[model samples]
Target: MSETIRRHPEAATLMSYAAGTLCEPLAAVVTAHLSMCEDCRHEVEDLELIGAGLLGSLAPAVGPAIRIPKRPLECEALTDAPVVERRRPDHLPAPIAQVYGLGFDTIPWKRLGPGVWHHRLELSAGVEGDLRLLKIGPGREMPDHGHGGSELTLVLDGAYADETGEYRRGDLQDADEDVEHRPVADKIVGCVCLIASERPARFKSIVGKLLQPWTGM
Candidate 1:
């Protein structure tokens, strides 16, 4: 790997996730990574062990026997092979192979330009403005635009920047309508991001509508 984007090691995020301390978008990044990185999976298990140890030392407390659920396929799919690979939906980071593989490719990702493209993913059908993936491609830049809804992005393989700053893997960029951005990805290797948008793009024009279909806005 060229190492264009600096990945904040899974250790930090895993620990936070195990402790239930990370925010939603950030946790999603960690969960997305854990789907690929065995090291992080072990780290989360270690944290669970530590927690169990702590619980063992504590006095027994009364609580409901709630059935904690497991993510769809861990033991069979992810844990078996153990090596992360780039994804086809714009060759996402090795960690996000599951995310791309699960259902991203099935959706129609429309191109905005030579290098720019995106697709609107269904997070919750009932929710009017639900979280959706705004997939960006290598080295392309979005126009100077603002969000009418909230936007949360986790950098998977590459990185992007705006008037705010740069976002790398495991780096979460939370943007509100107040945020106006024109992000440019690295030209050579390009980048892929898992962007959950609360609102649609504010650039309402012929070109904007073309971009809108990809976002389902």
Candidate 2:
């Protein structure tokens, strides 16, 4: 899967994730990509090690002494207990599956337009961002648009192509405010993507703009 993944999040984006600085929505997209791309997983691991070393080298800040709380001796008995792993759907990434909590085929898709469907994911209260799963019908083309802020898209299934290039399963496309393109779904398989954006998209077409309030893209 890593070998076939030609697209990946930018180095800066990975660094932010490694440093634990990315917001929940953006981090979710990166986490999904990392699950399928071995190369990216390794990259993030290396980045984390580097971050740890840097933190270790920094001078410790002077602060008030912290108190430790005592726990019952029985609490230690659970130390040797086997861990129970949560099962997830094979087709969906772990992060997405955890949030969606449903099979891909069972998604209650809301129509965005003729051939585009989306299901928005909920974020914590007061969280400022957008995250959703987009399902595009075969040969469908999205409206031309530019991002208002940063946007990260992870291909969960099939493929899509834009001015940048083609993105297939396990591929991640990182776009910012300056990027403007119309993405077209694959003719045969169409596309299913997990998208996270810092702000709403800026549509080039009036029709797209008019629908933005309803679609919440």
The lowest-lDDT stretch of 10 consecutive residues in candidate 1 is: 61-70
lDDT of each candidate versus the true structure: 0.55, 0.79
TM-score of 2: 0.83
Runs off by more than 4 Å, candidate 1: 1-109, 130-138, 204-206
Looking at model 2, report the run of 10 residues with the lowest lDDT sum.
62-71
TM-score of each: 0.54, 0.83
lDDT of 1 by residue, 25-141 (tens): 345545554543455556677776676577785433211111111334443464556443324553443333443343334445666567766654333224345333455666677
Estimate, for each residue in 40-74, the C-alpha lDDT of model 2 and write its tens digit: 87788777777777888543322111101112333
Q: List clashing residue pairs in candidate 1.
A: 138-190, 149-199
- Which candidate ranks first by lDDT, i.e. highest? 2
lDDT score of residue 89 within candidate 1: 50
